[model samples]
Target: MRIIHVAVIAMLVFAAAYVYRIKMESTVRTEKVLQLHAEVRKEREAIAQLRAEWAKLDAPGRLQGLAERHLKLKPINARQFDQLKNLPERPPSIVNPGDPDPIASMIEKIDPDIITGSLPVPEAAH
Candidate 1:
């Protein structure tokens, strides 16, 4: 009867130790999770700040100002516009009509069997 009592006490002690260890591990993990959440919040705030700066930098007026200052460009004038019909006719074709296409000759040099594999086609199922 005393032996049985001692065994029960030992088992209870072991269970208590296991529960304490699990509680400690859970507490550590909880702290790590909280730290990660804080880091994520900080990263989100940084991204918001960068987006605000990007909006300021990408404003159309700011871009036009930068282009005018750096590129020394001028705005379009009414005289600059021209009718498409006023454009000159395209120049004559460079290749002679008698000449065969160079690309076609290069393709003809390769074996047709190599392109469409040497494997026999399977018979069509009924």
Candidate 2:
């Protein structure tokens, strides 16, 4: 009877240790899940911040103001163009009308059967 009691006590102790180990492992897993969730939240916040900054930088009114302050530029008119008086004339084409078509010489140079007909393909030249 005393031996039976000792075995029962040992079994109870082992069962308690098993339950405690399982509880600790579940707690560790939950902590890891929370840490991953926090990291994802931080990344989402960074993306939102970057998008807001991009929106502000690309505003049209801000761009126009920057251009006016930095460039100090103006539009031109026909009055500015008319100020130029003595421009040179363009040269005429150098081709002579009496000359025959240049393509006729190239056609004479190339064999008609090579390009115009179904000829056997040659092997690699290299």
Candidate 3:
């Protein structure tokens, strides 16, 4: 009889423990879901703010000002174009001193290992 009573008590304790574990797990999951939703809302707000800032930066008046300052320059007349066309072709003797010969020296200076897969390095300055 005593053994039967102890068995009933043990079963009751196990059932209580199972219910407690399930309740705790559900609470944790609900908290995690709330946190994820909050994070998504924050990211959406940030994206909206960035889009507004981009719109302000691309305003037409600001763009026009920037163009006038940097790239809106133009010649006054067709005479400048005629003068440019009248200029003589440069002689080969005046080859630019700053330019290097890619066909001759550059080809020879290339490392054979770089052409093959044996070397992992990018092409270095000659």
Task: Look at candidate 1 and tell me the lDDT of residue 72.
Answer: 71
Models sorted by lDDT, best on top: 1, 2, 3
Question: Candidate 1 — what's its lDDT?
Answer: 0.89
Per-model TM-score, in order, reads 0.67, 0.55, 0.57
Please, what are the lDDT tens digits per residue for candidate 1 over residues 68-116?
A: 8899778799999899999999996555566579566556666765647
Residues 1-126, model 3: lDDT tens digits: 999999999999999999999999999999999999999999999999999999999999999889889996875885666665778996654333565874565566667655566766667889
Best by lDDT: 1
Residue-level lDDT of model 2, residues 6-49, one tens digit each, is: 99999999999999999999999999999999999999999999
Candidate 1 Cα deviation (angstroms), residue 97: 14
The lDDT values for all models are 0.89, 0.85, 0.84
Q: Can you rank all candidates by TM-score, best first?
A: 1, 3, 2
Q: What TM-score does candidate 2 get on C-alpha atoms?
A: 0.55
Candidate 3 local distance difference test against the native: 0.84
Q: Count the clashes in each prediction.
A: 0, 0, 0
Count backbone clashes in candidate 1: 0
Q: How accurate is candidate 2 locally (lDDT)?
A: 0.85
